[model samples]
Target: MKRFWNWNQDGDQRQLAISGVIAPDSWIHDNVSPQVFQDELNESQGPIDLWLNSPGGDCTAASQIYTMLMNYPNDVNVKISGIAASAASVIAMAGTTVSMAPSAMLMIHNPLTIVGGQEKDLDHAAQMLVETKEAIINAYELKTNLPREKISAMMDDETWMNVNKAIELGFADQMLGDDHQPTDCYSYSDKQSDLVVLNKLKRTSQNTISVKSLQKRLSLLSH
Candidate 1:
């Protein structure tokens, strides 16, 4: 895999899928890069199905992606099938509708950093982190309607929530497999003349759809 994160439009361009960590290409493995993310976001149209299974990384990257999703022209549906913790949780907050798999987990906490500097530098760093946390809280509050104090306390405690707990706390709007079906899908067939699928999901991995795959798909469509 080129990276853990993958971005691609589903068949018909009605929906898109964004999977894996939110900050790939960082020193950390299994993360999404901000540049790649922006390119993907720019090309996205209509509704998007963002499948998140991440441990999170690079708060700044997550924050930027969050803003991009929030500003998208159409709706964004975030589906968490594994984990959306730390900065990934922040990105989840941008979803127009956030759903968690029955067994998925969500976590929230204060931003972390490594610092080596004078007292003034330390103080400034603390203040910057506080602002970052507050910004994160804004995203959460928009979805959960929870007070800032409550959200902050949850962060302070490093809270982890499952599906039901997530809904109870307003962290998630619904459970996966609710009213909306999985919106992201693909199509492929060994014989173009028979068993043509409109939209089927393989979901094999969080890896980029290879160019060969796209070409094959187009060739099949043109036949």
Candidate 2:
């Protein structure tokens, strides 16, 4: 069986890299089980630096990993090196401090599951999904402190965030650098309004703009 997580000793800190789909060995036949991961984590020494890059897979596996990390005695700092999407985003919330590379991406969306049965079974599945989404919201809320309503809406929209947006929304604490911090140049109560302005600038400039530049342009527009 292949391991989903890789652990390497780096001086006083242990570096853990979590890449690819998250699933139990029984499901994938080649993926590491959560218990196996727990065993490795239990044996580790010093603080952990976790590097995440996954498209997400089983929610149950993610929840187990998240719980394990949350319960670990040492600090676990998560660094998003590529993308953390869907169930992987939930696991990312276990970090004591989360950081993202400048071009890394973070995505969140409503939970989905397949059901096969009669109408009653379908109804039960729907309820399960709803409850599952709320559980995911709990993780995001704990990390970002964003309102549940907003987080739900964003999930409904299948929100995708770049490093700047992740930091702005508190999904990530900072950019990966010695002096990087969350961008605070602009704030908007309405996400739609923010998107409109961002879309307008994208069209006008025919390119992406930095948060600082966006702030300057927004200020000019207000004046």
Candidate 3:
């Protein structure tokens, strides 16, 4: 697996880019293990600018990263430059100042599991999933302060939020960087191919194009 954290030094400005899947082997090549993340976080000090572009993975792994960030005795600002979905959204909750690029997306959903076993085994798995869902909700509740029922309903629907909605819903705190500039371009895994259709990027100052618009454009392409 490729190491996901690295220093990007531009003159005196430094930042760590968390720019892919959250857990080991989420994709065939790029994955971040908890050990790898811990090692990187420990080696780095002072103020950190964390740039996120992830579709999320491995809730336990994300939770560990979130805890580590929260415990670090330094200012850590999170900037979502592309997409922060699932477990990635959970990690973003740790930011002292969480921000989203204009075109970035944030998604949240109930815990998911795939299982096939005896009835008792299935029952146990279901119970575990329920506990995990609650834990995930706890992170959102702490960050958003929205009613638990509302949050739960959104999660149940696998809701997708763009930059404005993310901030409005309390998933993010601010809009980061130059507003005129285009958000960073990223590629989702083939697993997400069915959801994201590849389209040539189109941007304009007259209108702010969003992920939802891109999805609609892609949907049109498919038909």
Candidate 4:
């Protein structure tokens, strides 16, 4: 994953280029230092243009970046160049004005977790997930002015919105530039491999016998 937010300043103009993954290991965390942000803020005399192109990562990091942008003194304009999914959506809403390229996509979904724990721990985890979901819904409602219930349902369904749909939903404010041909990251070969693995797992499970049946047979043998 590549991630980085670049701050460029020329005389009175300033812009921040944000691209790639939004995780701890991404370019944003590694290359975009706090000093860079500060320097841009101090030197720039104009509004900041934030160009975003990301697949989303690290909720906590995205939240931090969102807060930073929201609290910035100057105006923030976000231009989505590609896809902004999950936590990236949150950061996009931090901008004073959000613009998406014709080919861009916006996706939202509930947080996910995989846990191995006792019943009590599992219950607690479920509760935490619910609360997190509610929080994410609240953010969407605040930005889009849509009903929380509707937003919550969309999140549950893992909604994927195109640029036009995003604009209609109020998630995107404007469409910028001409549209290009859409390309899916996953190839046909990858899909075939996934299907083969799934089929093998299904076959293996189908061939397995229940332990309860084996135990009953053992009891009969002992008699």
Candidate 5:
């Protein structure tokens, strides 16, 4: 089985690279499950320098990973080396300090699922998605301090943010570079703060459509 995450310890900081799709072990062979990640994290010492590059995948998996990172005792400095979209964006929110590459991007949107059943089942699925969206909002709201309604609206529109825009909107703390000091914040045009993702949208797979698989994956989320 191929692994989606790579870990390397240097000095007191543990470097974790999260790439490709995030999913439970039973769901797929190539994706990284939250349990496997947690096992590695439990044994690590000191702070974490997590490098994230993913188009997102199973939300249940992402939610567990997010919770683990949030509950970690030490600091978790997230470095966005590439795009972090959908469920991957949720994991990014666990960062104590989030830094984005100059050309990197981030995206968030409402959760989606494929349901096959009667009218009542469909209604149940819709309600579940609504609740899931609220749960996801908790993470983003905690990180960005943006209003829940505003965040909902952004998710409704499938918001995409670039480096400067990410900092402006509180999705990111600062731009990654050697020239800028750690405390320096990036600047953005008020009018251009919400730019369309354009060509990059194609790079990210549809990771939010795993709600149908949640029932099967929930067992892996046990603490």
Candidate 6:
């Protein structure tokens, strides 16, 4: 069987399924290129069901996919079967109707990058990042009327939202399939708490090593 998100149009709905992770060499960029996306859009007889479960990769590639979906004439329904994080969430917002399985998740975060350059080069990279972020924010805003500040905060925190939470935040228009609740909803506070515990353990281990070093020094001095 063909993998999901690889531009397989042999489904029941005569709808194309775009599923799986998003990366430069991923199905979106390799198997389903821009031409393929245009062909699919031109030939689609009905609504397109986009199943997203990806950590997200390749901002440029994801942007291409997002643009194609947004330009499609037919209705585009995005179903979050597992998780849509990072750039994957940008594509999801392009769907005319966004829904999520009761057990599925959606994550939104600011675009991140690593750069090494002089001050001027770094400034240019920073500007590009800002533009990219604004583009993503515009897409989300178009889909849901949520305030920019709210969306910005959520993205800054790398917020994870379950079905109900997604609906409440306007990330998802509805919930599909099952009527189950998510295991637990986490906020930035929860992440911080976990980090605190981890830091405490590290500090305790360091103190133990320091005491051992002091003991060895005292023994040597006595000798």
Per-residue C-alpha lDDT of model 1 across residues 55-127, encoded as one tens digit per residue: 8887877787788887777667788989999999998888767778878999999999889889999999999
Query: Relative to the true structure, how large is the alpha-carbon lDDT of every model?
Result: 0.70, 0.79, 0.72, 0.68, 0.77, 0.67
What order do you get sorting by TM-score, best first? 5, 2, 3, 1, 6, 4
- Could you give candidate 5's per-residue lDDT for residues 108-216 as a string of tens digits? 9999888989999999999999999999999888677678999999999999999878878778876788334542455553222211111112112245734334323
Task: Give per-model TM-scores.
Answer: 0.72, 0.78, 0.72, 0.68, 0.78, 0.70
Error of 4 at 52 (Å): 0.8
Q: Flag regions of model 1 displaced more than 4 Å.
A: 1-4, 13-21, 24-33, 180-223
Backbone atom clashes (below 3 Å) for every candidate: 5, 0, 0, 3, 0, 1
The TM-score of candidate 6 is: 0.70
Q: What tens-digit string does per-residue lDDT give for candidate 3 at 61-162? A: 788888888776666778999999999999888776677887889999988878998999999999999999999888887666678999999999999998
Poorest stretch of ten by lDDT in candidate 2: 179-188
RMSD of each: 14.4, 11.7, 14.1, 21.2, 12.9, 20.2
Write the residue-wise lDDT of candidate 6 on 1-223 in tens digits: 2333545565556455555655546443365465655675677556677778887776776788788876665567788888888888888877766678878888888998789989998999999899988888887775655678878888889899888777666677667763342213322233223322332232334445553464455456556
Error (Å) of candidate 1 at residue 143 is 1.3
Worst 10 residues of 1 by lDDT: 193-202
Identify the runs in model 6 with alpha carbons over 4 angstroms from their true place: 1-4, 8-12, 26-32, 178-223
The order of the candidates by lDDT, greatest first, is 2, 5, 3, 1, 4, 6
Q: Comparing 4 and 5 by lDDT, which wins?
A: 5
